[model samples]
Target: MKGSYSLLDIDSSTGDVYLAKGASIGICLGAVKVPRVNPDTRNVTYAGTMSGCSNCFSSDGTGTLYNLSATAVSTKIRPTSVLGSLDVATGEPRDSVAVRRGPSAGMVVDGKNRFAVAAFTAPEGTSYIGSGTAFVPDNNATGQMVIIDLTTGDVVRTMSGFRVGGHGGSLVHGGLMNSVQLDPSTRTGWTYGPYHEQIHQFSY
Candidate 1:
């Protein structure tokens, strides 16, 4: 069960196992047991972190939360490269990128079997690299949509610079985002974070 500090995954049928450490890490992993035990709870019970997060299932029938933050490349912070799957069971990932920054907060899997990551961004770099602030001026500004292709385990596209400067008196902060969904039937992706108020649509 993914919670404020721990990640747990349990296979309802076979009882396989997986786990991530820390409260923030666990939250990002999500919790499978919560839904089964508490019907009133929402799917996003667990939140993630900026450095250690991912979505995984545990052997105990629980969900997982994880982070996909940017990795250091030479001297600059690049989003294209990051550590492999934080899940020990999955070992290291092959084609994966930190689709989000400042703690990927939340993510949803589409019926098409692809993952659409929500994160902050600026300058439209190679990946999700934003200050995580909802809205900021100049260097701390945040805006962008990070898309991850689950099938290929790699970032397919990025919608960055959707907004500039805090609009409508809203200040940007590195916190939970409220834009990210997928339409299974149509294979469309949507992302609307605080920085970019506009709802973004995309096709795989």
Candidate 2:
């Protein structure tokens, strides 16, 4: 936990913050870590990890965690990703499916926990910034957005043309607001433009 961190979600049962991190920022080492300090006592309370999970985990506001990508080892991108969930209390994977399109740019579950929408960056090639630094080049690539049924692990509908230029290998990165949020009753959502500063609305 001495490296850079990207906050993924919070475990409601314990109030612990779970994060996706790397040896440095803007890269992933292929694990999600949850380490927390009790607010009242300011003491280390709990620490746990979920191996092989990355980007976009949403809590159903109960205890269920929905994730976009997971694997057995550190693979940045593949033809497909194993979409799954983790136990909020233990940081262990509960269930998964090989139906996700690719690595997620962002994701959100509906208020009912019955469905999810995620951004998948199409698999292209990768480039290295340093001898051991590897990253997905998002500058000229496009991504897909999909609506999925959580229970059946099936992608019911998909929308293409989302962009994926999340972050470069720089020590400092910004403007990569590639996440999603939803309004249940309306069945609509919004996200930032993939290449520019514009807000796009999604209705599906």
Q: Which candidate is the best by lDDT?
A: 2
What is the per-residue lDDT of model 1 for residues 64-106, given as tens digits with 9 covering 90 to 100?
2233333222222222323233222333333345444333333
lDDT of candidate 2 at residue 195, scale 0 to 100: 69
For model 2, state the Cα shift of residue 21 in Å: 3.2
Candidate 1 yields a Cα-based lDDT of: 0.38
The most accurate candidate by TM-score is: 2
Off by over 4 Å in 1: 1-106, 124-142, 161-174, 193-204
lDDT score for residue 86 of model 1: 29
RMSD of candidate 1 to the truth, in angstroms, is 9.1
TM-score of each: 0.42, 0.66
